[model samples]
Target chain A: MGLMETFFNLDVLHSSALALLEGLKLTITLGLTSLVTSFAAGLILVLGRLYGPMPIRVIAIAFIDIFRAIPLLVLLVLVYYALPFVGINFSPFWAAVTALSLVASAYAAECFRAGIEAVAIGQFEAAKALGFSWTDMMKDVVLPQALRLVIPPSTGIGISLIKDTALASVVAMPDLLKQALQAQAFYANPSPLIGAALLYLIILLPLVRIVSSIEERQKRAAGR
Target chain B: MTHQKATQPFIKITDLQKFYGQFQALHDINLAVEKGQILALIGPSGSGKSTLVRCINLLEQFQAGTIEVDGIEVKEGRNLNKVRAEVGMVFQQFNLFPHMTALKNVAIAPVRVRGISWEEAEKKALALLERVGLSQHAHKRPSQLSGGQQQRVAIARALAMEPEVLLFDEPTSALDPEMVGEVLDVIQKVAETGVTMLIVTHEMSFARRVSNRVIFMEQGRIIEDTPPEEFFGCGPKTDRAQLFIRSVLQGHPDAGLTAPLQVLED
Candidate 1:
């Protein structure tokens, strides 16, 4: 038999599909939890960097730079293994979330900062002239407009984070990649690896398309 | 002494000085505006006319003077929100909130700053828009409206705040010539309401028609401050003010016809 027949055996493909399906639920949950945590943290960091006092601004900048510089793999290792030495122990799932969110938040914060800065200074001046306090302006006018401007970039970040959840398998979280590896070992074939790639494609293709369309609409709205 | 000497001015500025890095933008300026008075400020570019108006509302800080708006002193580290809530400013660029409709732009401050109910704010905003002849366009955003229409909405927005004083910083200078008359007409109507106002403008005729007093500045110093008729009457005043009026009015033959300064010059 050809290599394709060996790899694409019906029995192996069926079993691989079943195993991967079981892992999808955990993968989705991991993606969602990390995304929400990262987005909220990112907003706070962006605001701190942009409008906070000197001490907070310095700390936020340092945090963003450090997280962005570290590889996700190293961060996961540090959170899962090294953190225990400091008497802080998190389960593997919590470890994956903490590590992924920290790294994702750094990138998202940059995206939010760029979006907020892109709004005209005149908007703030007008809001101030109307007697809006700093916090009021941010909540009522600035953030609403900035969020609209950032949708495409933030979606890009979200899609990247979803794919990065696969890295959780390193800490043995039994996510999609881990389940596929187990199937590969059991079946002694690479078919499960192919199935995992297809699953990623299925999840990410619609997200990528949505991001592109939003970018196009934004450009058109800007009269470019 | 002037008749205004009998009553204290609602807005007062004394020994005002402003600096931008190494450059001085305003110097030792003293001025006052009585309630129900309309004062016009006209000057060549870089003369700090706009800066002076900005200083009154605490939009620009002066280094050496005190500005009192309706008894609230303009100072750093004070609760400026109370002062701002009482002073409404109209900008050269209109500066309407682009994301909101005209009605919302006019209504938002009353709701957010004053804690007025949304229903009442919207109702009052609609009335203000009607006063500006923009009732039919209440739902339009700044980006959807013409420059002139947007400015009218801005005026209505300022009016909705029920401010003690209104400051216009060259409100019509950014409009096309044909569009200027509509905005000026709306301002004239606003003036008729007897609201205290300070206007910084280049429209000499409108300044003469609507203002009780006109102030001319050069190099950050007030060259002359007098009644509009006297300021434009070719009487004894700063030569710089005379040259500025002449240059700005050069193309219009019928300029100053009502207050014929040319005859006085001859």
Candidate 2:
């Protein structure tokens, strides 16, 4: 077959577009769910690591270090394939989300820690001297400032998590990449896979632009 | 002196010794402050002026000390908020919450810590902004205000707590030269309200004018503690304090030695 027929066949892409759309919907759902879960889990983990008593801090540190070091694909396979042998069965979707959140939460925790530490010591002293309780200080003073600082990095994590949703296909979750693979097999053409890549790009490009603009704005704010 | 009815001092520090990992920051410090008295702490840098003020509110833990604020003995593991609520502090950095408007900065502690209604706290906060001559700037964030205005807001924030004792740790040290007068004016107003104040300052003229007592410290020890008139006029009893004062006078050359010397005649 010629190159266009093999990889860029419009007819094949048009025929498979509906199936790809269904997969894209699932991918988005998975990505959003994991994004929220990981972000929240990251916050809790960071708080524990920074403020909790000895055992919780140790456990949080271990969890962050181990999950951050593990390969996502290996973790996905382990969650989907190994856990069933141990009498714990998660559906493909839950398994994918579990694996993605575990790894992404570790990254998110580090980002939050960096942001919190970057807050000036004077800010903490001011809050403390005002007689703010620890919880109130974090909520009203420290976290608000830290949240602004972590936006660019955290959004970078979110984008990577969305792209990682493609890895869900390995566990039979029928996400975008899996659907693309099926369409390619049925049509005997690679155009469906290229079309799936294009769809991912369509959704992600704007987010990438937003992250850069936010970073640019923060730099400008800092410069002033 | 109207608030000095209690027989006991409002704040008492006994044998206060502070350390930072084997480096002593304060040594054998004992002091007493009566209610409504403004005591200015003067010393070289690293002489524990800031550390001593911080210890009163338990912002810095001491290795050995008994600091009693308004008769409550400060200690570790005690609820520091209880102590801090009664002792407001103004920092050199101003340390105003950059994210908040000046009004919110002044009002937040009262609303959150004192459990006052937001509406009431804001009203009081506005009055405080007016007192500091920044009522028009109340809506601006710290980033929008100049350093002096920010420090005034900081003083207003501290005053909103209605603290019995106020600590100013080089309050005007961080401002541009032109801005110092405005902040000092607000501090003078606060001092007039008769809050017991411990001020760590390098402004010799301000210390001589505003504080009743002047303390000269060096190497973490108090070398001179006397009435501001005596300390700045007859000059300090200790040679160390005398030398320090002479150097300070030489640097500023306008710290108003003549005024304090005139006070000696009166």
TM-score for each predicted model, relative to the true structure: 0.93, 0.95
> Model 2 has how many clashing residue pairs?
0
In Å, what is the interface RMSD of model 1? 1.0
Best by TM-score: 2
| Model 1 vs. true fold: TM | 0.93
Least accurate 10 contiguous residues by lDDT in model 1 chain A: A1-10
Off by over 4 Å in 1: A3-7, B1-8, B251-266
Candidate maximizing DockQ: 2
lDDT per residue for candidate 2 within A65-90, as digits (tens), equals 99999999999999999999999999
After superposition, candidate 2 runs with Cα above 4 Å error: B1-5, B252-266
Q: Which pairs of residues have clashing backbones in candidate 2?
A: none
Query: lDDT tens string, model 1, B1-266?
Result: 12234467788888999999889999899988788889998877788999999887777877888987767678755568877888889999998888899999999999999999999999999999999999999999888899999999999999999987899998987888679899999999999999888999877778888999989988899989899879876542878777777766563332222222332332
